[model samples]
Target: MSDLRRRALAGGKTVSRKARSKPESGLSSGNHTPNGSPGNSRAGSRANSRPGSRYASEDEYASESENDDIMTISTNSVSGEDDPGNTWAERLQDRVAELQDRKRSSVQGREATLGAYNHLLKHHFAQRQLDKSVAELMPILLRGIRNGSSDEERLRTLQAFTLTVLTCSPETIFEQALPILKAACQDADAENVKVEAIYALCIAVSYGGGSSTAAEETLDFFLEIIESDGQSVGAPDSGAVVTAALQAWAFVASHMEDLTVQSEAAIEAFIEQLDSSDPDVQTSAGVNIALLFEAAREYEEETGESFDMQYNQHRIMTRMAEIVRDSSKSVSKKGRRHLRSNFSSIVTSLERGKGPGYSTAGRAGPNPHTGGPRTDEQGEFREFGYRERIRIYNQFLLINTWSLHSRAELLKTLLGGGFGIHYLENPIVKDILGSADVEYIPNAKSRK
Candidate 1:
C-alpha cells in the first residue's frame, strides 16, 4: 500500500512538470507560468488584471490617465482663484455680484452682459451647460417679480427666462423651469411682469408643459381683474389690463381644444362687451365673436356636426337687417349695405339648395308709375301688379340680382314682347325715365 501511494504522487508531479514545460500559446489556460514568453506573460498579466484593467497598456487607459492628470491640474489651479475658504453659497454671492457689476456699467456693456447671461441661461436650461445659471436665475426672476422692478428690466429678464424655458427640451424645462413660470404668474406685481409672465406661460405651454392648466389660471386671473370693482378706477390703466386679458384669451383660445367649455363665463363676458358704448371695445368684441364663429364653422365642417344646431341664424340676420334699417346710428348705411350684400348671397345659396333656404332677393320690385320702387311709403308692398312685376324684373336685371337667374327665361313673358330700350324709360315712369331711346320704340317714326 505504501509503494502504490508513492507511485501515484510521482505520476501527478510528472504530469504537472510536463504541463509547465510545454510552450505557452498566449491563450488563457487555468494555470500560468512566470517567464513563459513575452506574449504569454502579457496575456497572463491581462487575465490577472482588475475589472478596469488598470495594468493594461491600451491607448484608452493612456488617454484617460492624461485627461485625469489635466483635470487634477485644472482643479488645483482654479481652487484658489476665488477664496479657498469661501462656501459654495459665498461663491454664488460673489458671482452674482460680478454679474450685477457688469450690468451697472455703460449701456453697451450692460447689454453685452445681459446677452451673455441669456446665453448661459439658455445653455443651462438646455442641459448643455449644466451649471449654476439655472439655479441662480430662478431667484433673480422671483426677486424681480416680488419687488416690482422697472418695466424694461422686468421685461428683459422675463423675456430671457421665457426664451430659455421655451427653447429647452420638454423634460428639462418641465422639471426645472415650470415651477418658476408658475411662481412668476402667481407672484408678479408689475403689470408688465404679469403680462410677460402670462406670455412666458403661454410659450411654455406651447412647448408642452402644463399649458392647459396654466392657460386656465391665467384666464381666471384676467377675469378677476376684469370683474373687480377697482376696474372702474381711472388710475390703474384698466384699458391695459383689459387688453392683456384679451390677448391672453386669444392665446388660450388658440391652444385649447374646447376653449368655450373651459371659458364659457369669460366668453359670455366678452359677448356682453359687444354692446359697450366704446366703439373700440365693441369692435374688439365683434372681431373675437367672429373669430369664434369662424372656428366653430370650421370645426363643424371637419367633424360633420353643428356646434349649435338649434342656434337662431334668423335672429342674427334680422338683427343685422334692423341695424341697417335703423338709419339713426353712425354705421347705419354701412350696416345696411353689408346686410343687403350678405342677405343677397344667402338668398342665392339657399335658392341653389346648398344652405338653409330663405329668399328675400326680389322683396324690392319696381312700380308701374315709378318704374323702380319709389323711395317713399307707397312703394312698400307685400306683393306687386303685372306692370310693377315687369319693372321689378328690369330692376333685378340692372342689379344683376342673384336667386333670379331664371329671370332671363321669363323676360318675354313679363314684357309681352322682347324688351326694348324704350321700356327702360317711359314718360309715365316717375323714376328711370330720363334719356329715352327713340330708335327702339315702335312709335319712334310717328313721334319724329
Candidate 2:
C-alpha cells in the first residue's frame, strides 16, 4: 500500500481495474511464436483470442482500443485521405507499413515494442506482406526489450520476442538475448515487470549462453529480491507477482552451479518467509528452502570442498521449530505447525550426510528418505520417479544434521509437532517422538 510500490505496479499511473483494461502479458507456455519461428503465426491472430487458451495473468493490460499505454490512438475521429484512417484494421496496417518503411536500427523503446507486435500482426494477418526473417526481426526485439518506458511495455516486448528467440540458435541468444534479459531483471520498474524480467532471465539460461558474470548476476539478483523485506507482498495483486518471483528464484537456484555467499543469503531469505502472513508465501518459502539445500549439496559433490551452508542451518531450523512450538495469538498455529512438520519430514527422509538429488517437485524419482507414498490424490500433477529422484535427494539426505542436542532447548522446540501428522502418516520426526526425555519447549519467542 506504500505510494512507491503502488506507483511501481501501476507504471506511475492510477486507474481503477474496471476503468482501465491492462494489455496481455508475454509469458509464453512454450517456445514463443513470433512471426517466423516454426509453428509461428501472427500473435495477434491467435493469442487470448481463443476461449480456454491459457492466457497470461489476468492483470495483463494493453490493446489497440483499451490500453492507452500500448496503443497510440489518433486524435481525429475520421481517417484522412492520405492516412490509413481510425479503424483498427487501418491502424494496424499503418503501423506495420510505418515499421517496414522506417530504418530498423532506429527503432527503440515502447514504440519499438509496438512496432514488433505490429510486425507479428503483419505476418499473421497478411503473409503476402511478410518479408522479415527471424534474424532480421531479433534486433528490433532486443532494442524493444531494452527500450520500453514502462514495465508493461518491456514485458509485452519480451513476450512477443520469446518465440522468435526460442526458435533461433542458442548461441546467438547467448550473445544477444542474455544481456537484454539481465538488464530487465536488474532494471527499476514495477514488481510485476521485475518478475517478468527474472522469468526471462531464467528462460535465457535454458538457451545455453551468457558469461559466468551474467550467471552470477542473475543468481545474485533473485537472492537480493528474496532477502528484500519489501512491503509490496501485502498487495492483493502482489502475491501473483511475488509467486512469479519465487518461481523464478527457484529456477535460477536449481540451475546455478556454484555455492557462494548468496546461497546463505537465499537461505536467510527463505527463513524470513516463515513469518509471512500469507500461507501460500509460507508454503512456497518452505519448499524453496529445500531447493537451496539441494543446490548446495550439488556444488559440494561436484567439488571436493564443503559448500559452507553452515551459516544459518541451525538457527533457521531453530526458528522453524520455534514457529511450530509457539502457540500464540500472533502466529497461525495450523500453518506454522504444518510447515514445521514438512521440514521434519524432509529431515527424516534425507540421508544424514548426503546431498539432495531430487528437486522440489521430485522430478528425479521417488524419494528414498521418505519411504511412504509420495503420491497424493490431490496432487493432480505430482510425479515421483526412480534413481533420478534417488540421486537428487542424496544431497539433502543429511541436511541440517548438526547437533541440536547441544542446544536442548532447540531440540525441544522441534518436538512441538513431533506427532503432528497432518501432512503425512509418519510423525514429524519419528525418532524424536519415540525418545523418552524430550519435552516441548515452552514459551519460545514469537516469530517476527
lDDT of 1 by residue, 133-227 (tens): 54444455444434433444455456555544433324335444456655664555555555556556555554535556765675565555444
With candidate 2 superimposed using the best TM-score fit, by how many Å does residue 423's alpha carbon deviate from the native? 31
Cα lDDT listed for each candidate: 0.36, 0.40
Per-prediction count of colliding residue pairs?
0, 34
Off by over 4 Å in 2: 1-132, 149-152, 174-189, 205-208, 230-245, 299-304, 311-318, 321-448
By summed lDDT, which 10 consecutive residues of candidate 2 come out lowest?
48-57
All candidates' TM-scores? 0.39, 0.45
lDDT of 2: 0.40
Candidate number with greatest TM-score: 2
User: Model 1 reaches what TM-score against the true structure?
Assistant: 0.39
- lDDT by residue (tens digit), candidate 2, 82-172: 3222233333333333333334322232334253343333122222222233444556566767876555556655654543333332445
